[model samples]
Target: MVSLSLGELISSHRSRRNLSLSDLAEMSGVSKSTLSSIESGETKRPSYTTWKKIADAMDIAPSTIINAFVDTTYHPKTLEIVLAEVIREGWEALVAKVAIRYLESPRIDTFRALDHIDGTARDTENKRIKRILCDSIITFTRSRGIPSYLASALYERYLIERDDFSRFEETYRRGKELLLYTEHLYTEDRIDYYYKMGVHANILGLHDESIELCRLGLREDRTDSKQKASAYISLFNSCVYFGDIHVAAIYLKEYENSQYADFRKNHFRATLLAKKGQHEEAIELFRVCLQEAKKEGRISIVVDLMASYLEAGKTDELLRLIESEDQFLPEATPQHPYRMKTLAQYYRRKALCLISLEKFDQGFHSLSESIKYFKQLGTTSEVIDGIRLFLRHHRTNNKNLSFKNMEILEDICDNII
Candidate 1:
């Protein structure tokens, strides 16, 4: 199990084939300088694409080159470095192949490494890198003949990356088809797929469908406790979204008894309390959950908590929470899914606060800003929701709204909602 340096391995392979560096470079379609650097150990970590090309030129498996860079126990950071190099070189397909082989290594922390890479790619704020990582994972999972659950997870990730309901619907439909008819997927994969489908359904506002899918997942007698816990949470969230608090409460209790109960339980408890008009208690619980979400770097959950604050009519508290934050409405970038909807919601909440405080002009301005972001998001449902919010709040507090603002709200709702 001698761990030869990558350069030494390359040189040995080239000499065994009696090919000069230039000959290898020509065959591999890589620059001679890059190849030289790799063989001289100057490039300690060559891209997966580069290694694959060289391996192909030398008529050897790409894993041979990958193995040259690691011994029996390699740190996860080493994998991240290689993945970053592969992504930078735009060698998604090659990296997929390499990743599949790497997963077979007994010493590798497969899921942890994959999850770390996924999170890193997400936080990178580079659209190209995110796209490459998505493509690589999809290709790797699908081609490696691994469990279909991995492929389904990657598809879900891509759906989030795309951030379009239409694409999500299409992907979910396709996943359903595969889960129902494909022989390659195991029961466990099917359960995982169903659970994810249920969660995404809730995200897309298909509450009933989400509940059904989650129930279907839970019905699987072979499902492990962890999977069952996930299904229960999905069911609870879906029920909560559909305004069935009693049913949601039942699931919440079950979830609390499950092994995964922790921060998520408190988050759900806060949601239930808020729904029941217990704002003060909900706010306290939300603050705790928000702190934990921040520590976990779960931006979406933080946004959810902010929305909850607004729903609880704790505008002053929400404003105070966001006043000193710099990344509250993180600069929208092409690499990451646009946070237009989240930003729009934030502005709408601000408008509500202003209106409640009798600041009509500032409130109108905030409303207008929210509408602008909603229009940019270009989703019919979101626009309709925005319009509905404006109309509902105006109707409930017409005495406080100026005639001009009322007219504007009427026009917007008449045209959209």
Candidate 2:
């Protein structure tokens, strides 16, 4: 038998019984406004008691009404089924169409659906889908005034994905303009926006801004344990980058004391040790964190652990870590901006190790490959870091460098930076 939406079923049954909404409101003792909302699909999931009252007034079983109303609407199960299908099938045109339709609904499920669709679109480099999803979100938000946080979240992410920081800075200004109005946001959305935007700001090297946003999130009294933990972690990262080591240590300690402490704590501890000039202890902890992160499928942190080894001046260990991680490395596609940055860093570290070992030709080529990946990202800070790496090496190895090699390095730096 065909299924119907809650609204459709209610409207059809009421019509067959020749009951106006006024009559139903009087018979069911539910308010006319509420009854109208139910029939119009504005109130998708009224409480069981409400549904029961309406069902009893119509001389029907609540179970029959509930079962018959299960259809492809804004129910949680419908969202789950659509997400599962999208995951199973890969993002096809049909899936994209259905995803857009589902995302246009003004519900929490619609927010979740948009997140899933946006993730797949980013992975697959589906810019069209991303734009469409953003438009759909804008339309829904304008119409409903709910899920407002998604506009900032998705727009910031889209800008970050393309490494378009010029536009991002403008967006950031607009975001700051909205900060005073954030009291209108749902608590969960407020916390989530702060956490995400804080992390994004940190990644983009806006450490002060990152710290400010994360602190705002932490100040929200209604934040849950997970939300608070996330805020603390973001604060810790920003403090570390902002060179406020004392504050970073405090945040780390707070996270360690929290119930959410896990392998991530080891990673943060390793970072702290590295900052304090305790390279040996940091390296050991990094090794443990790398293993655990790999087991947990945290690819991003695994790359970071590799960088930690490089930063500690353990070139030999860094090389070995790269080789060992070859099998597990995700494909570094130009389409995937974050992966491109990761590979750029990976290759840059490998090039440094090779150069330190006197493998000139291979090292130069590896460095070139690293620069190529960084160029695709349209980012300059990382490219400047690569140039600094060359300069530092050249200073120490001046005698080892052939005059021709020095010219090549200068040319690379001048051309890029």
Highest TM-score among the candidates is held by which one?
A: 2
Error of 2 at 400 (Å): 16
Model 2 misplaced regions, further than 4 Å? 1-177, 225-228, 257-261, 295-315, 331-343, 372-378, 384-417
Tens digit of lDDT per residue, candidate 2, span 155-262? Answer: 434444334532333445545544654666677666766766676566556788888888887777553477577668778877887678899999999888888766
User: Candidate 1's residue-wise lDDT over 41-89, tens digit each?
Assistant: 7887676567778878888754455555543224455565665665566
The TM-score that candidate 1 achieves is: 0.47
Error of 1 at 317 (Å): 3.7
* True-structure Cα RMSD, model 1: 13.3
Quote the lDDT for 171 in model 2: 49
| Candidate 2 minimal-lDDT segment of 10 residues | 161-170
Quote the lDDT for 316 in model 1. 67
Question: Clashing residue pairs, candidate 1?
Answer: 127-335
